[model samples]
Target: MHIAAQAYGRTSKTGLPTRELEATLLSQSAARLAAARDRRADDFALVVEALEENRKLWSLLVRASSAPESELPDALKQNVAKLGAFIFQKTIDLIENAEPEGFTALAEINRNIAAGLRGIPADA
Candidate 1:
């Protein structure tokens, strides 16, 4: 997925609202990570692939949020950047350790962010 092409709060070429597109992407990534974690014993490669995809998504979000042209408030931008850094570190740790519990945090973070983008509560 060329997530870099999808700008937040705008309509994308696919006609979906970019916010919704982002939410969908996050949700999908979360699902993939969760599934891969569950099946890691069967195919560890799936976990690696899912983690890579999630890292790419977070890279796009961190870059966009940190861009000078971004409309996000400084606090929000900083928070997102911090979260991205954590995500990146966690991804590396999981890649090296292959711990199933590590995937849980990543999936939860994606789900919470997706819910926020959709204007819904994370626990909903």
Candidate 2:
């Protein structure tokens, strides 16, 4: 199933609000990336798979935020687009160079965004 559709289905089944579902997905992506980063030395393929998943999640976000029917604010949509571009570039860079440190920014961004969606401070 498509990631967005799966998320929607999960929300409907669990009675979670859209924002909460989004936050949960983001957190899951972040955790996957972080775990892959930590285990990169043991298994490089994990990193690649995690990066692909993160990219897919970001792609969905970018498309949704950019859609004309989206309720996201213009500034937020622009920010998501910019972040998506960076994430795509970073994913390519990591795939090419295989730097564990590079995963930090990607995971951090997801975590911060998830926290925002949950109405919590990133640090907290």
Query: What is the Cα root-mean-square deviation between model 1 and the actual structure?
Result: 2.5
Model 2 / residue 29 / CA error / Å: 0.8
TM-score of each: 0.89, 0.91
Q: What lDDT would candidate 1 get against the real structure? A: 0.87
Give the range where candidate 1 is weakest over 10 consecutive residues by summed lDDT. 1-10
Scored by TM-score, the top model is 2
lDDT of 2 by residue, 5-40 (tens): 688667767889888888888899899899988998
Model 2 spans with C-alpha error above 4 angstroms: 2-5
Worst 10 residues of 2 by lDDT: 1-10
How many collisions between residues are there in candidate 2?
0
Best by lDDT: 2
Cα deviation of 24, candidate 2, in Å: 0.6
